[model samples]
Target chain A: MHPLAPVTAVGRSTLSMLAAIGRVTIFLGATLTHLVRPPFYPREFLSALLSIGWFSLPVVGLTTLFTGGALALQIYAGGARFNAEAVVPQIVAIGMVRELGPVLTGLMVAGRVAASIAAEVGTMKVTEQIDALVTLSTNPMKYLTVPRVLAATLALPLLAAVGNVIGILGGYLVGTTRLDFNAAVYLTNTVDFLEAADVVSGLVKAAVFGFIVALMGCYHGMNSGRGAQGVGRATTNAVVSSSILILASNYLLTEVFFSA
Target chain B: MIAMQDVHKAFGPKKVLRGVTLDVARGESLVIIGGSGTGKSVTIKCILGLVTPDTGLITLDGQDVRRAERDAFLARFGMLFQGGALFDSLSVWQNVAFRLLRGALKRPRAEAREIAIEKLRRVGLTPDVADLFPAELSGGMQKRVGLARAIAAEPEIIFFDEPTTGLDPIMAGVINDLIREIVVEMGATAITITHDMSSVRAIADKVAMLHDGVIQWTGPVARMDTSGDPFVEQFIHGRAEGPIEAVR
Candidate 1:
């Protein structure tokens, strides 16, 4: 191999990564700019809210329920070593409200809403529908990205709030029925343990996660290459990128909210 | 009038349009013909500012297309895409009335629907098809719907990107004739990109052949049969062995 071959490969990959980052940054700026501008499509925003928020509740609920139950069982088992199994209710409540609730809801949405948005918009791009929108005196950023992004940003917090409630209830159920704890005491312990900061931070994380999911979907979609394969690739990229960003941001936000 | 001067475009290392130049007069139908992947679409897209050229100047009515206020400029033009490109989620009437339902040109919903129905009828589609989604319609019906949408706002310029592509021969002829009638009636400046010889005969006032990122020959449609340019002759006759090499 040539002596410079390694250097060339590394340089090329680095440039490609930088280009991708540049494209995404520019797209973020464009989306934010369009979000504040006039000519908003309320109908599109409402439809996106329905699809991204309302339709996603069942999956989010089920995921959190199972997670909360399993978390309660694990916490009880771990606490039993110290004769502290009574901490299950408080631990489960804190876990559900502070971390798992928002993070899991985000991942679920990254799977559902992100992939759907990418597929829909990528297909539209492939078929020249986006160009058609431009020809029709419509700015695609305003018509498509802004609405989806705004809807997701506004919807995920509500979804997380609902999921948090349902998750805490799941833990209560498990703590009482499965672990032989008193139901009323489990409820009181959970209520006493979770502060407003915990719940509010979770909701804040949900909002940011929502924005990431929608933004990744739109960015991948608007830049989709050219055919069925391109659209498929865009959908996969949307899910993968959004999920990674969600997990990474979860850590950072946790640091900001809870690190002491 | 629209003009493109030495427009150059490339996607990475593959050059699409290289020093391409062309012009279209007001109330004239200029049909660009070429082998697949010869930058015909890129040329039109450059004019529309959908695809920016790497280097060039494009002017419509003596003003640079990119410098014009976007909405006002786009509102003066219409486009019929190759695959119809109808918004699948919208009903046919909504697709047709897309421009009229929003932006600076917005009209009342009832009025937009009425205009959409009228345009649909003009494109030979019945009013009953107005409520059907693009996905529910046949390919031919979809193209008609796209054409209806293109003409709905009565723009001063119309672009037809392979308007008859994917249609049966009869439907292709019908669409060509419809396009011809519309262009003549509207007296709009028009640009069409297609390889179909029949589309050329039916719709072109002037025909330009694009090849290898350049306009090989352009002239009145009547002179096309005897244009004497090898590229034009080979393309019009659908010859495989010629200056134009088949990609495969």
Candidate 2:
């Protein structure tokens, strides 16, 4: 009703958003602090590693396989613009290692792992299992968040590396069988084109993305509102935010790694 | 002893606890009763430090709860939540043995399992229930397991929040009986929050009636009916017409 109502609404929304960022930053800082502190849960860490890494393999592997095959085809076709079609092996290898492999693996794991963590922890929060943990003299951050974040951070790089190999193999398979290229020559060109920097950068991106994914999931979950709808919203926010942060961090990391 | 003085807590514009004061001496069983959303649970949470008061003093054994070392302080108390709050991922024995398996109360796996089975038996659950996950248990069984967990570490103080919520009356009676027996046998200080009158009669040595974010009346259980406080009278009698206005 007031003339200044529109401005007030915008200001309120902006303030709320900033508050959310501040809270998430605090959650992240606490998680990192607890990660190094001891009375660590080796059982919880091993279990989380199994869930986030080993369980994620099939989905990450499948996504990269299909993506690598398609990337090889697209590169071959695009190269034909200048009759440079034979560059498929080189381009496919570079593209998969430098960008697509890590990004896709990150996003896939984000969707699968982040959503589960949020739903799981959100349920725990609302149902008072988290409070129960507190009453039992255990820090939920140390017990729940640290193990999960550490597992994801450590596992994603390994997952990405495996994804890189599988993806390159996919490209190799497609180039040789579907595109009628010499298998040995394609392998040599693929091997020759990808530098160590490319692989390292992608793995590093995978690690950061992994951290963002679990952090968002834990952050949203521990702060979730009371019931089923609250947990559902936390899960959605975890997946969406993690996916977006993954892409954003990927670009930023790439720039930092490759830019002069 | 646990003591609270003029405890006040608010969430946004909704003031849940205006000014609450209560006390439970060591080895006493105190039951808090109020309608839903009347801050009955908040009062218990304040004592446990699960929820901090906006303003007031809460002390346990003469130590300021806010200043107590968290692990050492928490080690003295255990709680049973309304929903059982069992970790779905953990089997029943593991849930019961949660405190024993980690942190300051760490025990070897075999010893913890033995303690878990013993506690579960104390709560009238079979040893067979130990290996099964919480999801496989019914609401009553889950409550029993939650009770088992609360006593696993044999804490000096125990709290039961809406301990009979969502269970059948027969199961509720069993839980109430178990609570009374456990409190008496362990000689642990007990605090319970509930609107259920049956729970009050079964569990309270002293009863406190909460209304409008404050303790309206508190007295020994024998004097509850004769206390003549309108809020207590209306709440205990389930009266619709009284000084205590029922929300439509």
Candidate 3:
């Protein structure tokens, strides 16, 4: 194959992907803009809070605990070679507060919350309930999308904070029992390593990830195609896109906060 | 009143509505008859702006519907979907009062619930059913709840897309009677799309047959027997042979 031929094909494919992304970005922005305007539905918002927030706590909490305990064991094993095992508690605290806590919680919630929202809304769209809402003079964006987005945005940060505490506690348990670290020393090291800025930054990341997850779910659902296959594809796309964006965004945010 | 002139809609290679045109005067019930996939529902969807026509003008009460504010234009019409499309999350009364509970029509919750219960009664449903969710109700009850919701706002126009599609004859007749009674009582213009001859006879003042992306024939329901169009004859009588070809 000619080098020019391959270059042209690559460019075309990249352009098409960019165009698709642009369309979704514009759709999400318009939906968010509609969210802050009038024609608000309080009942729908309450239902979403019950569905997305309250129902999501147990799963998110469990994910955080296991991840924290695993992180503590890994850090202790790695530091043992250099006799830097004393650093386990400090590193685990900083790690949970700054990175694993928010990002892991976000990924887990996105898998559960985002996929379900997308599937439910997509099925409703395919079945013409969205059209029925429009005919009933209810804006679909306001009635369906806004409440989910709002609930996720407000609820995820709180969930992230809870996950962070649970994860650190898990790390403490592992450190005290398995590694033979003094409980008092472990607690002091953890306290000394974690700063308010780190926790605040993680919460901020959680909020942003929440917005992305909900936005992706609603966008894919609204633009889903005609049948069951269409709904399945939308749900898959919502989860994949949300997870990828969360990880990519975590890196960018970490760089912004720590590098500068 | 609703009118469509030279409407056209296509999905890629297949043209669904090709220059389809018709009109429904105020208080008239027009039943559009057609074989499956012949665009009866598409025509109603076009008028409702759920599926925008590629070209043509749709007007309601002399106002250009396609160019008007969508929510306000839609506010004048009520639609009973093929499956009833009731919101599963809401109680029966809330579903009925969905419109009145929000936006400009927002009412006190108690007042809205009372109005919902009254509408349910109008549709032959009891007050006790008002607290049940859509999923908890039977198919006929769901249809009645959908009808109650449709008429709750007292819209000027109503569209019924296969309103009796999945019902047994008895239940279908009950829904047909309810629709006719509501239309006449409200004096609302009604457009119903169905292949059910019983429904056509019960609800329509005028009947139009859709075939091959166009209106094959249209006239008062009394003249349906002598429509003189082979497609209409074949469809109305449920015959396998005529000008209409049945796929093997």
Candidate 4:
């Protein structure tokens, strides 16, 4: 072994990490540029919208609903010690709309959409289909990345909004039935405390999470390693990276939106 | 009409192509043969701008390929990938007519499908296979579909990367003949990359041997057997020894 081998290896790894970041940044830039350009593929966009938006509704709905119900029960039980049991409706609404709704829905999509996109594009990479697209005079970024990122960006906000509503409904059902709270009072509390800013912030976070998910998926897929192992690794990385990014960005967005 | 001058490329510490220089005149079929991993695929990819050279000049009709308008530059070429590379989601006709249905070459949907069907027939596939997906076809049929897709737009140039790979010898012969027939019929500049000597004999007007990243020898196909270059002789005769390290 060389005398400076250890130092050189560390330096090399750090440089490669930085280089990876730069490539992903450039990939994102290209995707955004292609998003606004002409020669759009409406059919591809529609297909992506259906897959990322419509098909994901059931999972998002069920996840948020159960979360909201459990949150209401937990808040009720915890609030009882302080004689603050009636706070269930307000807390659940705020929790679901301000943070949990978008965050959980994002994680769910990160699992579903990101993995699928990565696998599809990664397999395309290994099979030379992406190269085929280039040979056919179609920009792969335009054909593959733009529609997905655009659809996810536009769709997540809608999904989060729906999830927010469903979550509140779940809280209402649990609070009124499991607890002794009056139905009208719970509804009024939920309705009164939620400002437009809270809802808008959640939707904004959802959009950002959407962008991260699709970008990570496409970036990994387009640059997948070589074979079956490479595609599998790409899919895993897409999900893991998107999930981490979603969580990290969620905290940052929360600080921006709600910090005193 | 395509020329690559002293092209060099390396993927990290491993050098793939080192100073590869060759030219394919208009309406010529140039087949490049070499051992596996000798950068045969990379050479063609460099010309098509799929893989940028680390240092080199690639020109088409004397215009630098890198500086050319991407869409217009690529529109003049078609490629048949080694594995066919047909879209899994697309029906056979859709795969064939992909270029016609999109971008600068957009056509009416009905007209595009008609052309796709016509090309499919030219490649020896029946109209009944039009609606099938790529996964439904045999390897030979997939190659035919790939060939049809390659020629669907009547491109001015075509690249075939291992067209005879993964097929029975009989099927390989059929594809070789079809490729030769199509090149002549379209009057297109052509380049084929493969290690199969049979494919070389059937498809090449001229042959270039790539070894250790550079063109070791190039001449008319007729002169290939008597060229007397050790590398070409070893490769053409499929000898395991002489110069090239089989393990490398």
Candidate 5:
């Protein structure tokens, strides 16, 4: 048994971790560099906008719709204990707008969009389609990564805005129909409760989350190993990494936006 | 014309190319033959600058490729990847006309489609196949589509990687004939990588046998059988015993 074997293993893992971070940072830098450069592919960009935005609407809408309803019920029940049951509209509005709307949408997109981008691009890498693009005098980053990232960055905020409206509607429906509250009163309380800052902050977080999701997808995909299993791993890593980054960044952004 | 001098490439500890040197003259067709894992693909990729050599010089028309503007340098070359590598999302004509619809070679959409259909015809495909997706085509048809895409831009240098691999003998023969006819008609410099002797015989103006990370034998296709190099003889004859050891 070598005395420094444990130390060696730790050192090896640390170095590999650092190397992976270095690679991801470099890929992110290259993506940013290409974003500003010319030879843009508007066709690819338009197609990506459709994939990451329009197709993603239903899932984001549905997820937020349910969460808003559930949140109204939970806040009502918890407030009942404090003899403050009527705060349902205010709490639900604030919760949905400030956190649930953006975070839930980000997670759903991490599952749907990130996995999709990773699998598609990973398969392209495996099949040499990416190399084929290179041989055709096209830069893969400019043609591929830039479009999806830009689209997701733009689309997520739009989706989050839609989700906010639908989510507040969900809370309104539950408050009025199920909770024995007047519709006009619930709507008034909800509108009065939410500030411009709350909505803007979530949308801002959504944009950052969108960038993270697409970046992780493109990064894992472009660097995928050579086969089905490699692509599968890339897809999984894309979802996992983006989900974690979204949550982590949400906290950091929230702190920056609302900390005392 | 393409030239490689003392090319070397390594992925981690496994060295793929070690001091590989070869040349193809202007408008000549050269077929590189080697066993699997002999760096044949890597050698081709190096010439295309897809794989950068650790130590070597690759030149095109007496100019260093590394110094060439990337787009202008790549514009002169067309490639048929072994797996076809067609964009499945795109229909057949779109795949064939990919370059013609984008980048420096871009044409009007209608013009690109017309040219794509013409290239498809030249490769023995019907105009209807142009509207179909790559997945709808058979393997041989896919290969033909890939060939069509390769020549769509009218490149000065054309690379066919394993042109006859995984095809029926008749289909392989047809593809070989198309490639030979295309190369000669276009007067393009061609480099094909294949282990298939028939592809070599049909396509090579000159044959270079790559083995052990270097050129073991190279001469006119006429001199291949009598090259007197053990590696070349053992490879072309498909013998079990050879100077070049098999992986298995």
Candidate 6:
């Protein structure tokens, strides 16, 4: 084999990845432009809010509750070795409010909401509904992506705030019962340890993550290939890409907010 | 009112349309027929601007369609997709009145719903069907609903893709008749893509046969049977052995 063959293959793959990224960037830009233009679809936006926000509460609540409880127990166990188990309440509250609450909720919602949106829209694309929209004089991006992205951005922060409260309550329950910490003292410690910046930062992250998640879903759906196999591929890609991007963005946002 | 000149489209290794050229007159129902994957649907898509041709001019009236303001240009046309393509979340009336409820065409919800019902009734559906979703309708009923939606705004032009593809013979006949009646009554120029000869016979004023990315034959529907093109002859007769090979 030629010495440059491996290098050429790597270069080709990199270029393909860049092309994919460029396409998504163009899609997102167009969606944002349409969102701010006239012909806004209030009906579609309301439906999306109900679908992305109100319908998502049960899952976000349940996931946060369990995660908080698990974190409290783990921190207690780790701190016990140094006879510093009293720190568990503070750590659990900070953990849930500062990072885990928003990130985990985002990941879970990305899997559920993003996958559904991708599959539904992808199926429609394959079945020619998108073309129908065009012929009907409706912009598909305005009719589809704008509402979804707006709903997710407006809803995810509220979901995250609810998740934070529930998650802190879970930590409180575990701290008082399993670890024998006094309920009032644990509550006071949690309140004292968690600053407004921590909560605000998490909500901000949720909003950004929400936009990314819904954007990925709409992008993949609108650009999905033909047939059942193509739709399946798009659904899977939407979920995986959204989740990975959410986590990576979470880390970057966290570093920006917290790093000295 | 639609014209395509020297339209060419290719998909990677496979070329779909090549130098396809045709013209449709106002109030004329033109049906294009060809075997599957022979660019019949692609030609319709190109005319609708859903798929842009690599090199060609598609003009509506005397204006260049490819360069026209897309939304303004598209507002004059309606399409019935092969699958009906109704929004699953929307009710029948909502789907039908989708165009009338937005942009410059916006109307009051009640008014839109009334127009939707009127269109539905024109296609032989009752007002009650307007409240039901597309999923609740039978295939034939869904096709009727699609037809109703296509004409709800009474567009100047309409395109129907595989209007009778999955229907039984009787339902197909009903749909064909309905299409003909609606097109005549509305005086709208219509383009239909299908392999169903019965549909071609029932709905077409002019018939164009697409083969290997070009219009191979164009004539009145009555002359389609006698067209001297070997490809059109083999296709219309549905013969297994012909110059067109069946790929395994």
| Cα RMSDs, all models | 1.2, 1.1, 2.0, 1.9, 1.0, 1.4
CA displacement after TM-score superposition, residue B180 of candidate 4 (Å): 1.1
lDDT of 5 by residue, A1-260 (tens): 79999999999999998999999999999999999999888888899889998999999999988888898899889999989989999988889888998999899999999999999999999999999999999899998899999999999999999998888888888888899999999989988988899999999999999999999999999988889999999999999999999999999999999999
Which candidate order results from sorting by DockQ in descending order?
1, 2, 5, 4, 6, 3
- Residue A17, candidate 4: C-alpha displacement in angstroms: 3.5
Candidate 2's C-alpha runs over 4 A off are: A1-3
Clashes of each: 0, 0, 0, 0, 0, 0
Candidate 1 residues lying further than 4 Å off, grouped into runs, are A3-8
Off by over 4 Å in 5: A1-3
Task: Find the candidate with the highest DockQ and give its number.
Answer: 1
Q: Give DockQ for candidates 1 onward, in order.
A: 0.95, 0.92, 0.74, 0.89, 0.91, 0.83
Candidate 6 has what TM-score? 0.97
Please state the CAPRI-style docking class of candidate 3. Answer: medium
- lDDT per residue for candidate 4 within B6-50, as digits (tens), equals 999999998999999998999999999999999999998998888
lDDT by residue (A1-260, candidate 4, tens digit) is 99999999999999998998899989988888888888899999999999999999999999999999999999999999999998999999999998999999999999999999999999999999999999998989999999999999999999999999999999989999999789999999999998999999999999999999999999999989999999999999999999999999999999999899
Clashing pairs in 3: none
Global lDDT of each candidate: 0.94, 0.93, 0.90, 0.95, 0.93, 0.90
**What does the TM-score come to for chain B in model 6?**
0.97
| Model 4 steric clash pairs | none
Stretches of candidate 6 off by over 4 Å are A1-5
When sorted by lDDT, best at the front, the candidate numbers are: 4, 1, 5, 2, 6, 3
**Model 4: runs farther than 4 Å from truth?**
A1-14
Candidate 1 structure quality by residue, lDDT tens digits, B1-248: 99999999999999999999998999999999998999999999998899999998999899998899998899999999999999988999999999999999899999999999999999999999999999899999999999999999999999999989899999999999999999999998899999899999999999999999999999999999999999998888988888988762
CAPRI quality level assigned to candidate 4 from its DockQ score: high
* TM-score (0 to 1) for chain B of model 2: 0.98
Please provide TM-scores, in order, for all candidate models, with all chains considered together.
Answer: 0.98, 0.98, 0.96, 0.96, 0.98, 0.97
Fnat per candidate: 1.00, 1.00, 0.72, 0.97, 0.88, 0.88
Residue A66 displacement in candidate 4 (angstroms): 1.1
- TM-score, chain A, per candidate? 0.98, 0.98, 0.94, 0.95, 0.97, 0.97
Candidate 3 wrongly placed segments (more than 4 Å): A1-16
